[model samples]
Target: MSNAPITEIDIAAFTADPYPDLARMRAAAPITYVPQLGATLLTRRDDIHVQEKRTDVFSSEQPDGLMTLLMGENMMRKDGVAHLAERRILFPAVSPRTVQEHWKPVFETAANRVLDRLAPRGGCDLVTDYAMPVSAEALKAITGLVRMTPAEMDGASQAMIDGCANYAGNADVTRRCHAATALIDHHIDLMLSDPPPRSALAVQMQGGLAMTSIRANIKLVISGGQNEPRDAIAGTIWALLSHPEQLELIRQGMASYADAFAEYARWVSPIGMSPRRVARRDTVGGVTFEPGDRVFLMFGSAGRDEAHFQAADRFDIRRDTQAAISFGAGPHFCAGAAASRCLIAEIALPLAFRRLKNLRLAGDAPFSGWAFRGPTSVPVAWSL
Candidate 1:
């Protein structure tokens, strides 16, 4: 591999809480190779910000990479004109105008519907009862997989996410991921038989994208779209509950719900590390990279990079988060960003607080995963 400094990490520990180790790496070895992860990590914010846009060197077109091998080579795995072509095709469904004019109402309705059901429960795991359903329902509408239940949507998304990040090569994870993708294929076939008018699948079909590409791109949306928002919604709620002072700032109208969402994204960063393959030999951050080496742009760590943010580890809603790369910074920047912002900031966060009186935590809301991190279980209670 490259001549980067070597560091060892306990995968289990890293998954549970990676910031401490990431911080250590940023301080000492900004471009270090982790034997456990089999990749050189770029932990500092500036390095990642500068290098991510250099798709010429650190390419996303990893045909043999985990994401491609597991989820199929979607637009996220392509580069330059090839990537932009698919991105443009997929944009109509997630464009700012589309998200505001069409999907906003749908997302608002979905969030309210879930909250209506949970309003009487007094307490529930917000991750499942609220966040999961809301995210899945929006995804169902967006992806035109209305046939699948919220649970199915969430399950498939989580399985594929786990599979994509299964760098250690776990057979069971791979099997589940394959099963999930197969189910998605079945659903896509049904949708293709008679595509919905305005759904993402229908839009792509009309745009003349190949069937394989259509499937892969839809799966990519589901994998990221469902879980990231689910985690962000629940995690933001958990963050607010845990840090009432910050929540109070929003309550007093000193800060907006959008501020809370932005801060939480920077703090907890639901979608953490993005993997790239070295396309050619290059030096970045004073470290040399060879062609075909695996590199991880640690978005999670970048948000907390001390050089970028003051008191970076703390969850402060009022802090400026303009530098946060939670959505990504390259050609592969999340296409669903508008939809996610609408879902979380406009619909999910505000509605939950408005509808649920005396909202508070019921128990521990533990987060997990390094590659795709978010609160797994957010036990919460509210007045009936």
Candidate 2:
């Protein structure tokens, strides 16, 4: 009968691994209020979709009181014309045809290359070796980045990750955020300074787009690209381990398994929640929030809403999912979604199956901190 969310529920751990809490929220109210956070948490599939789709009513911008202090705004905060223009510049990489033509090769090349180096030796940190690189490579080639170095890309990305995972609204976080933004900004400037022929980024620069715009867009693209793959790859491997039957099912059905990555995406729902701003005067779950109330889209909880899916908590690679909002819905959905999935399909998932045998969760699972969930590090092994 209580409409309150379990506020003491370790949100960090939920971000680390949320299925357990998601179960509680779904059953309690489907749309419950977290009194501590001052925003109502909507967990049911219908409510989430309804809220996310109402772009005009629930603005993409968050109620920036405390959030802007932690995660700085980029495209995730934009709406209307600003959002469309930014997305258009980055959308080509994830376009249906571009995904088919460009991403598959990027994945194959990166996966095969990393595996070739690591497979003969037995095992390597999939997060560092295979998972992140596939995404990094695809993003670089797709973006036409002139400065092609994983170290540079990783540095820029890792700064943000560390910043996010350790976001305490303190001096350290401030340093990391500035440092990360600077590295990415400087790097993008160099590339724009010396435009190259046939480079994806160069193409954008020549498209009459401003470097200020490009800097923000590419920073977002690379940072997001880096963050999702680590957890997603880790989550995919985690799912395969927990559900060996499903893993084998995927192995036998390699062709159909190509799309299994998408299911894993929906099931894993890597980026735990998205922040939004309430459009105008409105009410939710009997709680009246003003024109600019900040709300966090509980995508993770919605994924496990029983009213939405059968055995909602299970990580079935074979689930009959009809486009879960893991990539979000409405206008502000992830522009690089297809590219992200392509990295997994063409790269991470395949190498994982080919090189690693009988992958199992290593010891106690380490929960990732901050807004994203999925173990911080997943350790698994196999016979060489």
Candidate 3:
């Protein structure tokens, strides 16, 4: 007997409100391919985790040559020995210790700088004005890129991210992505000519890392370091604002703000899905897959999987969120997860809430993007 024909779901609707359909898929066909995307969508936490751990079967280093086009030759596109070598070179700068000792102060300083401007307005677009600037400046400090400002980095980062979101072959997205890549490459070139006094790139050079590897990995960090924290900070604030009871818990000292950030990572999960490839024929979740298949580890759906989380749809700051896949798992776990957390939990969120006292949502703001989902513009108002 042949496998059932692949099903098709509305891509636009899925991007807008994925929860309803994701819920259906999670309940029924948690591991089946959709003809439209030509990939198996794994929505359940267990299935996603299973695929993520077995880099042997579901390789990041796919023979199909798709990621190479999108992400270039970075650590995300490597596997096994090659992946490890790249990780080792990049790890020193983003390690948990480094985040605590070096980047935390940078994050706090950047957060305060953005807050200084935002606090005076008494109202601002949290995503653009506050979160994006804070993330951009923090990344600037971390990467030590001398030529570009946070605004430039933010635009480039958004384009790269938007390209991934529109990976299904949109002409405008592809054009924007290529243009952003060229701009960032130029910035990288400028940085090389006039190296920063002390940055991660300099450390990589001093450590004898290859120039090509340095460029690719630096771009990866630039993409991630700017994007993830911006979304995380915005999502965390939105979650708190939407659930005032939970917000009250923090104000009343009943719950820690750090736990709220952790909960946001689980509940909303700034970046939803990470893609992997079927390196060799493998069977998972009662389905057999041939080589060269695309499997998307749906972290957004998994974060809300009923089996894994109690009242999964509800946003609760007190929920046990240590198991969330916001930063992913296995060999591909986010290298900058520590810094992202430090920036949100310790620096950005705390300062924003304190400075924007009695901050309330101006109105309902809708978040977009299936690949990376968070508030596009968090219209927030508060007393000066």
Candidate 4:
């Protein structure tokens, strides 16, 4: 909050290159309303943590906003007991044990299978060629969906994720998202007809959940599970490529990949912002807010908040991330965090570094999309 009036910036440019603007905002005004987007942006780490813990004050039950626009009115948009119950019902599928035991192998096999084809190429766009396929395959196995080519998964997942990304609800994005969502709907139907043994879909079917609720939750999983890891892995690689010393430290076993991944999540958080509704009139950080106001929890900015993190703008794998809210905090913490971590540490990053010996960037890689941020294209070359 600041004594000065709120300031507005172009959404498109800010999303494309948000770090500098985010730094300035955090310093000048931790909490401010963006007239251009009609949402209040919360950037400070402590402020966000306080707001997140108070679900009663800042609700997730946003109906006509981005959360519903992408995945329908699922648990993501529900607050209080309704959200708790839905999340509980959906919990077993992504539980740490379940993901580690069941989905880990799928991710490992997929990562190897992908690199098997791309490693020989000497150079490629890791975003499309590796990260997207590995993430999509893991989601397919977890959901018990029928086998799909990497390209198909990439296309479908990207369309739906893009729908989530273009949160302003552009007509083109909505249409594309709907078309991709149809594919996911079809898979849900197939799973309902004959649930896969021991899969998350099977758990839902056995639980006797309603078809509508099941579909909504399934789409939520598809949207989150499919997209988050893809962007995170790509972002991690891009971060490593940019910081070769840190990359070398990890490669030499001086630093663990898990630590590197955690730092990556903090430094270049893939899901830049999460939406919440101002549930009731509240005052925080000297700023007053009314009920029904829109709140964009700027997780990305929190990662770089100088008050919480030293050398916040620098990418340091050695930094402690006990306070990192990249997987979020409080009740709405991402259920898929463990799986995403396992994928990146055990499968994705290790393979990229080991198999693609002497891996180096092929060209400039820029990141975009404020809603779901990551390197747009990560081109790399390895020793032939």
Best by lDDT: 1
Which run of 10 residues does model 2 get worst, by summed lDDT? 62-71
**Each prediction's TM-score versus the true structure:** 0.99, 0.87, 0.95, 0.95
TM-score of 4: 0.95
lDDT of 3: 0.80
Residue runs of model 2 more than 4 Å from their true location after superposition: 1-8, 11-16, 35-38, 62-73, 146-148, 161-168, 194-200, 355-364
Residue-by-residue lDDT tens digits, candidate 3, 1-384: 114235578988978877887888888787767776667888898878767889988888854454467557888889989888878877777789888998888788878878887787878888888889899888887787756787888888887887766657889887887887787778777777656534668667766778777776777778788877888888789888989999999889899878998888787777888887777877776778777777788899989999979999899998888778878878899988888878888898889888888899887778876677888888889998
Ranking by lDDT: 1, 4, 3, 2
**Listing every candidate in turn, what is its Cα RMSD in Å to the true structure after a full C-alpha superposition?**
0.8, 3.4, 2.0, 2.0
Residue pairs whose backbone atoms clash in candidate 2: 15-373, 143-201, 144-200, 144-201
Worst 10 residues of 3 by lDDT: 1-10
Candidate 1: regions farther than 4 A off: none
Against the unseen true structure, what C-alpha lDDT does each candidate score?
0.92, 0.66, 0.80, 0.81
lDDT of 2 by residue, 165-282 (tens): 4424567765876687787666666676665443446655666666666665666666677768766876677677777788778668743455566677666677767767777776
2 versus 4: better lDDT goes to: 4
Preferred candidate (lDDT higher): 2 or 3:
3
lDDT of 1 by residue, 71-120 (tens): 89999999999999999998988999999999999998888889888898
Candidate 1: lDDT of 344?
94
Compose the digit string of candidate 4's lDDT tens values, residues 39-101: 788988888888897998889888777647666787778877988887777778888988788
Report the alpha-carbon TM-score of model 2 versus the true structure: 0.87
